[model samples]
Target: MLIAHLSDLHIRPQGMLYQGLVDSNTMCEQAIAHLNKLLPRPDVVIITGDLVDEGLPQEYAMARELLAGIEQPLLMIPGNHDDRTLMGSTFSQPYLSSTAGPWHFVADDLGPVRIIGVDVTVPLEHHGDMTEAAGAWLDAALAQEPTRPTLVMLHQPPFLSGIPYIDTYACRNSERLREVVQRYPAIERVVCGHIHRSMQLRFGGTVLCTAPSTTTAIGLALDAEAEEASYVEPPALLLHHWKVDTGLITHWVPIGTFRGPLPFA
Candidate 1:
């Protein structure tokens, strides 16, 4: 099974731009079109979050129209820039039936794989947290089907990226999130988006991957003295392919023009 992972759309109005420069909407359109044209279409597509530049009804409206192109089963969760109410109302599905809490955790079986999504958004705050109730909900969900090859997805990554600007907004209760995940060996990967860059690391016995922005990407500045910065780097999304005999693997696919797939000699 193949899964397409996209995040931090930062979608905005037709003429509007993000951070006063990036044209995210056009980038998202190109990414969706790219997904539609893949030879073996992905089994599932999950956008990790930040669906809109601002969590406005109009923004959601415009985003919904663009996202209609995706042919695969697409799943999404809340990000710091997302408003749960606005998102849920516009993109409601059977999987998002929860009403009482900020957690929108749900599990879907896809024959050889099970995709589980959870909400880690802190209201009106850029930082992320997994509440006690959300944690219990996840633990119970995983307990139900512990052996399935599950792919857990959330907005903020539990581990920190080297960039100080992004790390400050990472998941606060990381240990709680870790406890639930480490107990379930079936979880293959904890995929997330929020930093607007591609990063991966092993944490709590599982591989954690952070997707790059579908539009713009923050440069990789690993030095302690490096100042925070972002740029209009080549936009891209992630593809997680599950091989029964070999296990799961990830690929970062850029969303733009490239040379032809010439025949090998």
Candidate 2:
């Protein structure tokens, strides 16, 4: 199965732009168009979070319209920039393993993979957290099929990236979340989007990584005095393909103009 992952759309109103530079809406539209034309079309698309620049009702309306171009099943969670009620109302679903929460969803429909999306969005805050109940629900979902290939997705990453500024908003329940994740070996990858740049780490026997934003990227600054934001890197997404015999493989897909392979070989 092929799962296309993109994040941090931060889609704004028709004329508005993110950070006075990146045109998030146009970037997303182009991404949708590009994904639609890929060979062996993706079975589903999982957007990690930051679907809008602001958590406004109007933004959700615009987001829904732009995302309508996706030809495959779309699954989303919430980010610090998303409003739970508005997003949930806009994107309705009934195939989830548990409908107990507004942002958590579990999709088992994929032939060989199960998708478990958890909401760690903390209202009015840039950081992320998960209630004990959320952990319980996740435990139940993974416990249901311990040996099945599962992908756990959330907006904020459960592990820390070297960028100290962004790490300030790291998931608050990482310790607890890690405990739960470590107990389950079926989890192939813990995917997320928040840092707005591609990064990978090992956590709880699983690979924890963050996807680059569709709009702009957050620069990698490991120094203690570095600022919070920067856009020196190109935007990108992740493509994950899974097989029963070989586990899961991930490829970083960059967006925008580039030179072609001239058949140098």
Candidate 3:
């Protein structure tokens, strides 16, 4: 099964770009249109977070309408720029029956794969945290048998990406998140999105990948010693393909066309 992993749309009014610089809405529109034209449409669309620049009701309303056009099942979580209560109330569809828990944790079974999503937004904080409640919920979810090849999706990454600005606001209790993953051997990959850059790291023996946002990306400044590092980069997303017989393979597909279409067939 193929899954489209997208994040950080940061949708806002047409004229309202972050700090009056980036045109994120246009980027999001381009990404969605490209997604619609993929040869094998994604089995699911997992948006890690930062759905809005400011967690406003109007922003969420606009995002809700834009994403509603997707043809596949969609999942989401909250990032630093999102309001948990508002997000929960806005997107309310479950993969299973309504008897399951609320909007915090969502799980969907796609044939031989099980995709589980968790929200880690900390109210009023720019950083994110995987609370004790969320850990316990994950533990319980992992305990279930008939565990198909599992993929855990969240907003903030549990591991550092060698960048100070992004690491400072990453998942606070990463060890707790890792411990739970170690317990669940079925977990094949832990995918996340808040970094706004494509990255790969190892956590609890599972492959941890951070997908770049569909909006503007913060450049890789792992070595820059400046107080605040910044750079402009292309927006991108991830396409993750999982096979029960084989394993999970993810491709970082950058949105928008570049200068060339080199024919390599």
Candidate 4:
């Protein structure tokens, strides 16, 4: 099974620019086109969150329209920038449990992988927390299909990336979540977004990785006092190819056309 992972779309109202500079909408359209042209189409697409810039009805409408271009099954969870209720209403699908509090669900029908999406966003806040209830939910979900190849996805990463600015609002109480994940050996990967740039870290007993945004990338500043900034870096996405022998292998694919396929000398 091939899974295409996209994150931090930050779609704005049609014609509006993200942060009044980058054309996130247009870039997202390009990313979608990039996905559609893949040689072996992805079996499923999982978006980690921040689907819109602001939690507005218009933004959700635009997000819905833009995401409609995807040709494969889609699963999404909320990020700090998203309004759970509004997003649930806009992209109603069976994978989502409801159009209400804490959008979390399990999808077992998508190919050979079991996808468990956990919502850790604190409503109207920038930080995320894996509450005791949410942890219990995840524990039970994993128990249901103990032996299935599983992928757990959330918005904010459970581990701290060295970037100091974003880490201030990073997922809190993640140790609890990590403990739960450690017990479940079937989890192939814990994928996330929100950091903008691609990152990978070892967490629990599995690999945790973050995808680059389809729009702007948060500047990579490791200094303790560095100011927050974004750059128009090459937008990209992640593809995870899974097979019995190979397990799961990820590829970082940059968006847009580039000359290639030249024979090696």
**Highest-TM-score candidate:** 4
In candidate 1, what residue range of length 10 has the lowest lDDT sum?
A: 99-108
How displaced is residue 201 in candidate 2, in Å? 1.2
Q: Residue 234 in model 4: shift from native, Å? A: 0.4
Model 3 steric clash pairs: none
The pairs that clash in candidate 4 are: none
lDDT of 1 at 174: 90
Tell me the tens digit of each residue's lDDT in model 1 across 1-265.
9999999999886678887788888889999998888879898889999999899888899899999998877788889998888888888555766643474756566547788888898989998897798789899989988988888999998877778777889988999999899999989999999999888898778899999999877778877777878888999999999999866899999988798877885
Model 1, stretches more than 4 Å misplaced? 99-101
lDDT of 3 by residue, 31-98 (tens): 89888888789988888889888988888887887787788888777788987777767787565233
Clash count (model 2, backbone only): 0
Tell me each candidate's TM-score: 0.95, 0.94, 0.91, 0.98
Model 3 off-target regions past 4 Å? 95-103, 258-263
Which residue pairs in model 2 clash with each other?
Answer: none
State the C-alpha lDDT per candidate.
Answer: 0.86, 0.85, 0.79, 0.92
lDDT of 2: 0.85
Candidate 4 error regions (>4 Å): none
lDDT of 4 at 210: 95
Candidate ranking (lDDT, best to worst): 4, 1, 2, 3
lDDT of 4 by residue, 1-265 (tens): 9999999999999999999999999999999999999989999999999999899999999998999999898999999999988888788768665768687899899889888899999998998999999999999999998989999999988877878999988899999999999999889999999999999888999999999999999999998889998899999999999999988898999999898878885
- Candidate 4: C-alpha RMSD to true structure equals 1.0
